[model samples]
Target: MDLYARFDLPPPPPPTVFSRDHTDGRARMPNFASVDEVSKFVDASRLWRHSRGANDFLRFGTAYLLVISLLVAAGILHKIYKRSFWVFRIVPRGHSNILIPNVHNSWALFITPYLWILAASSIAHIIGDARNEPVVNISLWISIMWSPTLFAVWYQAWGLIAARLGDGSASFEELPGHSLTKSMPSWLINAVFLLLPVVPSVAASLVGAIGNAHLEHARYGWYDWHTKYDGTPELTRDMVLDAQNIFHESIRGAYHVCISQAIWGMMCFLFGTAHSFATSSLIFSIGDHLQAKRRAVLAQKPRIIPQALPTHAPVIDRSLPQISQSDFSFKWRTADEAISKPLPSITCDSMSTDNQHSRIETRMYTFGQRMHDQHISFFPAIKSSSTIVRIEASKAERVLNFFIIQSVSIMLGTVALISDSLYMALHSYAAAEANNYESAFITGYIAVVIITLLAGTGSFISSTHTTFEASFTALLYARRFDPGSSDISSSGGERTDFLNME
Candidate 1:
């Protein structure tokens, strides 16, 4: 139910050829020697249950301060609770990859950086509150933490990208997913994949946060960090003026040029943004495409019909010598034996004692005849199979990514423009009423950002959602499923277990 769990899955793997994903991994796909062997993995009905989906109780409870109450309860009940009081899980959906090592560890260990960032951010916020400078503290923290956080997010949830690399089954199908051109080498794609995150990570580290710090120090309380380190950058006068000038230009005179332009670097998202793509939405789209895919998989699932040998079992105790004495015989023949004569099976009715070919031999001849009649042949045709490619991120992919960057740039610029317009409106009203300007620009732009963030998050998620063990012991528990109640429903028939996953 929490907003963050989807992004909390494991990091995406380095780019690999399509083949290595299924066949080359250390884990072995189940091998079936017979129908019975394959049946071992099949379920009587789908084993997936709705409650088995991703549940980030840590994030959910912490979001509402419910964790505080949970902590108190856990302190009291620590003796009786031998099992975990809570669980957070992300089930592999459709054919999405998970547990590649084929083992689940403590979720805390599995996603270490997630907790690291959480602690870092919480401490930053606490420091901000302590300093009575929430704005400055947050601005600096976001800047310093931006790069690591980006890595952490991917480290946690990148595997979702793997799902888009191929169709759920072996063969590649691109209608609902992304596949870079075959000409693109996997090394190139790996390079691109590696470089994409670095773009924003470096950008955020360079300007987004540092710019805020420079602007705060220059225009507000001037501090020279040369004599002693104050933990802030040792920005030169030129750097301060430059950061201030560029930032003010971004503000678009909404702050009355000289004084009002400082709202804690509110427009600081200029050069740095996450390396997400419109492709990601298309990749993570939770619309009809995912539902359609699920339906297709279920519809295509192989139906197993139990087959049995004849109820009247065959008695086959006939000795080879006894059979040899009769018209029928079992003998190891060398090439010399067949050099001058047709084999018994090929000699008309002599292949069988009943003056006919055996059942298998007859079936083969009949199949050949049917094939000839139908003009059907498979020897010359290729069946569906997997292809391995190390792909480079395409020019098309780069173009799309750049496209999103421009779009975000325009969106932020538009937000600035609209904020300025509202400020003008407020300025006019204040002049007419002979009252205060009421800080309309700051309040107005922030409201716009909140509304935009809400809308974007909603649309984005109509798209994505990943797991582990150093197990997080839940301080409290919430049960949404009850076996005593026969209110069970299948996420099958329509969708799949992936959908049933929380």
Candidate 2:
């Protein structure tokens, strides 16, 4: 009322307005009708930008590192590091290995480079960051994902091979299943499993040691301290203090690197253990299915029992066949049995009493039971394929292995965190004076947090997926080869539910 009275001016347009790009370029206004709408708009814009930034950064860094490593490995390093380091070579067109196949070679193509990048990058970044240098870039940091990726590739390549071996043929359908190292003895399997974690753990430790050495060299100059501080205790106190500080920082930095290595190595070992279990399951399933198929084939075959002696044959009477059986209770006889009989049938008087008939039935049942037991004893494979399915499909082993890996990783992370916290707390005054050690500790703490979270998710998802796929494959094979078992279908349903729980 005041504005209208003051000057006959039109009300100003709402803030939520935009011009439409059209033939007329007309202005359009939306009703910001409710607070929800405004909030939604703001949220959408903010989230989109945030997601885009993170995605772009990761994408750019990964590609940059991958390309650079590939160029160096394939173009430059290939000539120098022939067998010692460069073990992979790209197959020329139409020249791929028949046994290994191109898919594997292609996978190794990417994975080998990634491994190289990871091994190099971890050392470089840890050393640089420890020394408080700006040498390590964002791209190198992002490439820390190399170890997990390596685990995945290693699992896949070996898993596929194991599975195919279980299937006993190179059919496309059987190309990607798992199997136990069946040909190997039990001792070999145990030995390999036990030794799986050692190599990577050792390598990580060595790398950490080298990085620590580098840190110490960088931290402490190569001059005689006694000469620099002049031998007097009072004059040398500050120098001695700095030396102690440098040594302490070097140890801390090295410890951080070692923890990271141990974490990744443990992860690799976890996958290795999972691979062994899955392979064993697959082999068990394959064995069951094959045995079932063999039994079914054998069962269908016509068995010819030796012709019994004349006295052993069932008595038959062709004469007075009109009666079909005389007082013989008129039991029907097959045409072949009637014709083969050596003697005529007995009369009604020869028919056995009811008690005798019961005794005979009991004898027949006992004989059949004895034969059944003997069959199972002779062919242990006669057990239902459903049991095999159940054993192979259980996710318990995979889950247990995963929890072990997770527990170990968490413990390492906690130790690293505690050590860093203690170091910072005890040297708070000196750290503040220098201002570098505190930052290093904080950085290490942050790294531990990020790595712990990533490792947890990566290990769980990858290991679960591998276990599920291998088990599912075994189930399919079991069902296909052992169609008589209704239990297989039910077990398959249970497996689906169990995987959903994971």
Candidate 3:
């Protein structure tokens, strides 16, 4: 108590003076009236804080959803178009030639869907501001939407390279009809398909990184609009507060959008990769089967050759005449004059022997039929029976194997898509419950990725199957007909002779 009383000095205070000689160049300090003045001054200069608004987040979410839905619709339409029964047509050329009519170009099939998705998404983005809830964050939505198209582009480019490297055509129509084994170029096609899905995922990661950088800048004071003060007039406190709220809301919306976009991008990449892998595997299996067919054909080495033979008949003489030596000489001279110097030395036995030997040689060397003893014989029946069995077995195996593999690939792709959708649904539910809108937006993006990946996988599988079928048909046709031979001759000669011979 005594110390407090001495230090407090309530009633009066004394001032001390210093001599200039003793004080070494010291300056006097200013005194504050009270601690309250310092506190009030500090409080006056400090920035005000406000709650983040929800309007901008709502706008972004609305836009994102609207755009994505349109994209989904477009994708569905594309699927319908591809699966339509009217897409294929058979065009007949004369009595012998048949062609499958192709309505749209290959590039059209690949590009049109992407274009539709892009257009629809763009429109949705433009109209988003008016909707109650925006589709998604605009920036994120755009990034996710662009992935499939970008993947397609990459796929196409890689496909071209692979085709060139394999010395094959780049068209989807060029794929093997049966198995990868049968089509020498099928592996290359599968490889290209497999490679395509990676591009979109990588692009997504890059975009995410960029978005994060922007987010960081925003987090700091770098882009803070509230900090800018012009000489014309300072913003009122309310205006400043409002601006800050708007900025925060915008940031939140953007962050949610980016998160959603990134998740979508990742899903797409994964789906695409999985699909490509599955399709490629199927293609390889088909190729292998086809190769087996080729090998079987090669091993058989069946040959066909025309048979030339002469008909034989017994000779019979009913009448004979006897002549004297003088008569004989007169008859010979008369015969020589009548038959234009007479036929030179008629040797029936010699001619007969030569013909028999030639026929024997032909029969011995030929692979198919042999006609001997005035009867069609053993070799023809054996050859024909073997050929029929081989053709039937080959065709059945190829078609069955290809169809099974393709079906499996399709099923797998579909299941993957479904799984992705389910996961998204769960994530969405969690986000909603937690009031974590950003997580919910990302969850919704899974649908886009799944759809795109499924589309690509389905297309590849279908195309591969088509290719196998075409190849098998081509092979069958080649085996059945001679490439060097004509079905119809140019000359107006009767086809009866050809028909009879066949």
lDDT of each: 0.27, 0.34, 0.34
- What stretches of model 2 exceed 4 Å from their correct place? 1-111, 114-146, 153-242, 265-273, 298-479, 483-502
Candidate achieving the largest TM-score: 1
Query: Candidate 2 at 8: error in angstroms?
Result: 85
* Regions of candidate 3 where Cα sits further than 4 Å from its true position: 1-114, 123-232, 303-502
Lowest lDDT 10-mer window, candidate 2? 356-365
Task: Pick out the ten consecutive residues of candidate 1 with the lowest summed lDDT.
Answer: 470-479
* TM-scores of all candidate predictions against the true structure: 0.30, 0.26, 0.28
The TM-score obtained by model 3 is: 0.28
Model 1, TM vs. native: 0.30
**Tens digits of per-residue lDDT for model 1, 45-100:** 01111111111322332242333223333432441253222222222323332221
| lDDT tens readout by residue for model 2, 62-89 | 4544554454346334433332122221
lDDT of 3 by residue, 1-502 (tens): 2312323322211111211122321111112233333222222211111113333433444454445445545543654565421221222122321112121122224434554554455444334434422333234334444555444434433332222211111223454453552354534534545555555556664665554443334333322433343231532433333333333333333443345454554564555455455335434543443444344333322221222233352343322222221121100010011112212223333232222111101011111111222112221111111111112334435554654554454445445544554454344323322223344443344344445444544434434453443333222112111212332336633121101100
Which 10-residue window in model 3 sums to the lowest lDDT? 328-337
